[model samples]
Target: MADSITVRGLSADAGQTPLLRDVSFEVRAGEVVTLFGPSGAGKTTIAMAVAGLTRPGVSLDGTVEAPARTGYLPQQAAGTLNPARRVGHALGELVGLRVPRMTRAQRRARVTEVLRAVAFEGDLGPVLRRYPAEFSGGQRTRLALAQVLATRPDALVLDEPTTGLDAGRKTELAGHLGALARNGVALLVVTHDPDVVAALDTRLLRVHNGVVTPSEAPQPRPTGATRPSVSCSGSPAAELRTVSVHFGSANVLREADLALFPGETVGLAGASGAGKSTVARCLAGLEQPSRGTVLAGGRPLPPLRRRTRAQLARVQYVWQEAAPSFDPRRPVEVQVAATATRLRGVCPGEALAEAREELAELGLTPAQAARYPPGLSGGQLQRAALARALLARPEVLLCDEVTTGLDTNLATHLLGHIDAYQRRTGAAVLLISHDPHVLTGRANRVLTVENGQMVG
Candidate 1:
């Protein structure tokens, strides 16, 4: 097998703290290699090092060899996407950069090819005109992949490719990536999805606490967590009644009525681009609906900024994209503490203490919480985001795709924290996720969002 990418004696450290130590791996052409690990376990560090990348203040001593044409799909879609740019323009610009000599017509043709390759069925013009915010979580991921696919690289490194995909979409992506591997494209995927590992079975490497070693078998889906039961008999904590959300002319949610009962975990289940987050945003006061009302404790709730601090503190939302939620310039701990300080009116000193405790409960070390957003992995940042929200101690908690980036063990651990919080405060939790297993044992009842309506 022809080695498409190789790393020998790769070691990375941030100042004095080592992130990766003497890690080595190789991916051959027409083969797939999956890196498995928990969040902040040095998986992303190894992946980026192999792609010849390192953050500021992080030094690398690595001998990495890869094809000149290598496409990288980053874990955080926030950095990969430009909010101001249309999907077509972003992808077309990348195509021009990859193939500088291509004519305008050729670039357009190339954009169409990649769009179809990622998610679009036939005509991509409709999709090309929309912005990233208009798409669902899974669709935005596909748009990011299309940007990478436009480069036509010989080797591809994808981080958390299944972050926002449903089970059906995950299967489709697995088959698509498998096809790419079969067609002579070396694939080095950093993922926590067992299905992806099972589909891309050529090679497996387990990265643990900054060490990489060969994995003997495919990873398995998480199970066996003692799920908390929901036994709530009370009025709604947060309610969205006849809510209709629209972005420009596109209808996101139509007459979607959702209620979160006290001491209940409600799972919002839906396919890609089905407006699940919109329903959540309505309750959180993040998105002002085109019609209907959002209620907190049965009272009509207004948009954010206009609401009182108490209203803001009562309803908390942990968004799907965790990295962009924090300030990259400051330490993540300070940001997490600020949430409690500002929303709950706790003293800065006590809030910081509680932030540290909360972060630790979510599996992030006190040291990891002190680093900037860029230094932490995607899943680590997610737990940090949850900690930030939990510190507010809201009566209504809305978690949007919280466990998507986490490994099975880590996911279960994080879910356990939520379960603990719910039992302690009897808060209402609206968990928006694509995992069927998560919904099965955890949620008291599942609401399916399809065609802009909530049912069953």
Candidate 2:
């Protein structure tokens, strides 16, 4: 069988700085190729190049071609989809004209079919009508994948597809891709998950420091310091009692209760639409609960806005997609410094200094702060978002799928910083993730959600 994709002498650079150099590879029909690397290794760049998104500044001198139609999934699903369009409309736009055209009913049937293939069992009937904002992080991702698959493209290029999905959904998506490979559709998956690498019949390619090389051996598993225990004394940093969220007649989150004590690291695990993020939003005061109450430092949190500035300062949230959190027009330093000045009452110069220091601690150099968000890599953007959050020195940190697109090394390093910071400051951390490995040795406690309800 002919190869689905072929690349030779692939080199790309940003201005004079190289991003990917002399990279060459091929993905044969009925096969999957896995790309692994640290942050800024140009994994996403390669995907973008294949998808024809590379711009003029990104100098390229290589040939990458696909025999069959190509479908590309960007790293940030939230930004990829049109917020104004419904889920069904997005999928409709991806279906190829060569495919059998169908009526609205037939199209809806096809949408439901692909969603089922991806293990999304929610009431998509309603979801199909709602905008992107109505779906949770994981749900939006599944919808995006379903959109790509609707075209029945000969080649599927997924960039960090498993980032926000829970374990079950991850496995399901893997199965779908595996089946696609069996059907003679070439698969190129860019991911940091070892389990994903092991599950597919893949040729492992590692990208590091602007170099891409084939790996003779599989990547190593991540390791970290021993897990710490949370003491039962003192007031819990945050508490949710029978919290529930209803959105337009649908119960997105059922009555759920959770407690985060000082110095505790709690991991929230669940498949898509399992209500993990809804819980996080409720605690952060971003989403008000339909019933029940949230307490911080043993006192009721005034309705999100009524809460005192100090109360609001105690809890900070870092989202998985940091690009939207940042203003494209603003410099990273200005964005970080502005938050610090507002929350900590620090002068602009002092706040800028603090932001620079925090960025350095998060593995970024001071020079990086002068650049805008669009220039940074996915890993850099995530770290910068965390740095912005840390600038406030909040007592409680609620992280929603923060390490989704990072490579193993970068993910390990970032998680270590979070752990170290928690240990030193005793700030409560609520980590939401789909990777069991991430929760295994790092989280002090693990909570699983299913069907919008906490199972345990």
**Winner by lDDT:** 1
Model 1 residue 432 CA deviation in Å: 0.8
Runs with alpha carbons beyond 4 Å of true place in candidate 2: 1-3, 55-57, 96-101, 122-126, 217-228, 303-308
Predict model 1's lDDT versus the native.
0.85
Residue 408 of model 2: what lDDT? 68
Q: TM-scores, in order shown?
A: 0.95, 0.92
Best model number under TM-score: 1
Per-residue CA lDDT of model 2 for 1-456, tens digit only, reads 354888788899877778888888888889888888777778888887777777435778888887557888888766878887777777765653546667767777777888787677757678678888777887787778877788778888888888677766777778888988999988888887777777666788887876778875456576454266668697899999888888888798888988899999988888776788888888888899999989998888867677766876799899877878899888888898887898878899999989998888878766567777776777789989988988888899999888877766777788888988887899999998877667778898788988788875
lDDT of 1 by residue, 1-456 (tens): 344998889888987898989888889999898898777888888778777787767898969998888888889854688889999889889899877999989999999988767656656777889988788778888888988888788999999877888877777787888888889999999988777777665588999978899986654655434246566556789998899998877788999888788999998899877899888888888889999999988788989979998899899999888988888899999999999999888999999999999988888887888999898889999999999999889999999999978888898899889989998998999989888767767887888999789988
Model 2 scores worst on lDDT over the 10 consecutive residues at 217-226
Give one clash count per candidate, in the order shown. Answer: 0, 0
